[model samples]
Target: MSMFLVRSFDDPKGYIELNRPDGTLPRTSSESYVPWGVSTHGKIVYAKTGEHTGWRGGTGQHRLRPYDTTVSQNRRRQCQSELGVMILNNPSFTAKAVSKVSNAMRLYLQSQDAATAMACIYKQIGHYFYTGGRFGFGRISESKKDDIGVDGVWRGIMQALLLGRLDQKMSIHDAIGRKVLPVLKGGQLVKYTNLATVVRQDWFDDPTRRGRVNAPVRAPVTTKGGISKLDTPAGGTVAQGRNRGVDMFSRDLHRTRDKDADAYYDDADARNLLFGAGISGTTGTLLQAGIAFGKLTAAEDLKQYTLAIIGYLVGGGMHSYHETMAVASKVGVPYNPGAFETSMPESFRRSGLYTAWRANFYDIVVLGATHWRNNSGYLPSHLNKELTSPA
Candidate 1:
């Protein structure tokens, strides 16, 4: 939600006014840079991120289940938020591909039992890399929100670390910002992104009626870049629409849109990411379900099963930690290193999982789904109160 002064709306010289705002603007500035550290933040981790425009998601999504009430994608903010959302999400335009050679290794090491314990220990990192039709990583609580396949803690961990590689792949904006760039004066994560590539030309088409940079009252920018848009993938509005996570059987699918909220997601590559995520998340749930049913063939050996279960927990925990450092990946936002601290482990500390994934974390991860059920929290108290409260 940070902003730069465009000098004059009537005739922008392309140079932003550099004087700091006098406590007037929303503190969304990424210009200032500092070495981010966990100690700087207390118990609750916080990652300051800004929207970037650069993505290839402009298609109709139908495969994954949606919520009862749909969300409006109509973007109406003041500043230009993204050069393009894809710019921040998909960075370098890398295609997601299932590694052929690695599959050979996977097959060689594949487990024939109803469940594969080896997976608890071995994950092919190179298998991801924005390949396999997979794309950008999702936000903190995005996975559970995307599909209704019951992505509990263990399953979420499996999905994030195993099959669902796109959550951390296919982003150049993140790579350059986290790895290539260093934190500068005011904790700014990114320096230059060459955003002109995706800047909507029409916004500047009419030289006379240009979009104001920081108007006195509200956002005047005519593009998607600006203040935070309403009901992000993590917002309360959209989150509540899905009844937290209770409306699992709801046949509706969360549709994808362009930065301008245009219908998209019909291309082969785009579909890859969508279906890839769906399948990945679904696969993890199925595995968890199988485990609940005692489907592991190795359990007959008692020793192996105990060892496998132990490995699953330990390895999953480590994977969750690894995600915190997955810069240019899903866990941490690009350019903003503090985002890592904000990252909640895949199996724990997810977006509002205290309700969405909490019970499952215990039932599945700890107790092996003794009380198996998917509950994303239908009647979220906070959401209900907000809705009924005096506006």
Candidate 2:
């Protein structure tokens, strides 16, 4: 007898297909049978048929297959979530991005001629002060319109000047050079190494080129016992010779390991200055607009103050973290948060929570004020009447 197996779509049951009563198998074409199935709980069961060869000769084979689309989709989502978490937690992502930006900035700086770059920098600095003065005075003028007089104007001018001078003194370039570049370049390891190289080069370079001639040889003094000996002990004592050798070795090692430190610092500083100036210019413009239109209530003002503090903390923390990483990488030292905290400057270390807060807070305030001013404008009287009567 010939037989075939059949299975239900929704349940596990088997049915047997037997041969005809005349003891002959029925001939079945490939497309004679249609398979149907339904999806249960996002799982689909379908019948598949193929030819199978056995002792009874070749026969048609059918099987029910199950697949869950929802499970596959969920797995895909989980994989994406894990990827996002990995990217977020990876320090190299931030470091590489920041490095790329810094490199691009450096290339731009290099492309500009020295005269042009300096001119642009100076022009930007002037604009920063000018806009800053306007914003500072404008805020005061708006708040004390009734009380503002000649003396008030003078006071505003004086205050603006003072503020501008302060801003210039605490220049953004200073922050980039003293904080950003050092961290980005991996700290004093690079700086000291470069300095040592320069020192070694100078020590080895011939002084005759600069118009300094070698000292004349002194005559050897003859001892009373007829022992002739040159003064200064023929290149000084063994200890002095050893010290010189040690110094040269140290310098050579430094140069070999950190050859481009000084050059990197200079490039990094220039790039940072250019970038910082652009940011400052944008900030000044926003602050000027805010001073022109935004009204500050006590609550709103307090919120801004809080936001500014938060911004500073975030900015400073990022800077510190990157710097710590750079330093650790350069020195072959294991990274530790406590080490970074200890290495920070006294002012920054003491005000650990407030290190980058000032810059961040200022940015937030200007941006928030600009947003409020733009959105909280007075509605036209005509529009209000139209809305009330018709809509």
lDDT of 1 by residue, 189-228 (tens): 2112222122222322322222112213332212121123
Off by over 4 Å in 2: 1-124, 128-169, 172-320, 323-339, 347-391
Any idea what lDDT model 2 has? Answer: 0.25
Query: What TM-score does candidate 1 reach?
Result: 0.18
lDDT of 2 by residue, 196-243 (tens): 322232212322211112223322212111001122221111100011
Error of 2 at 86 (Å): 29
Candidate 1 segments exceeding 4 Å error: 1-379, 382-391
Candidate 1 clash figure, as a count: 43
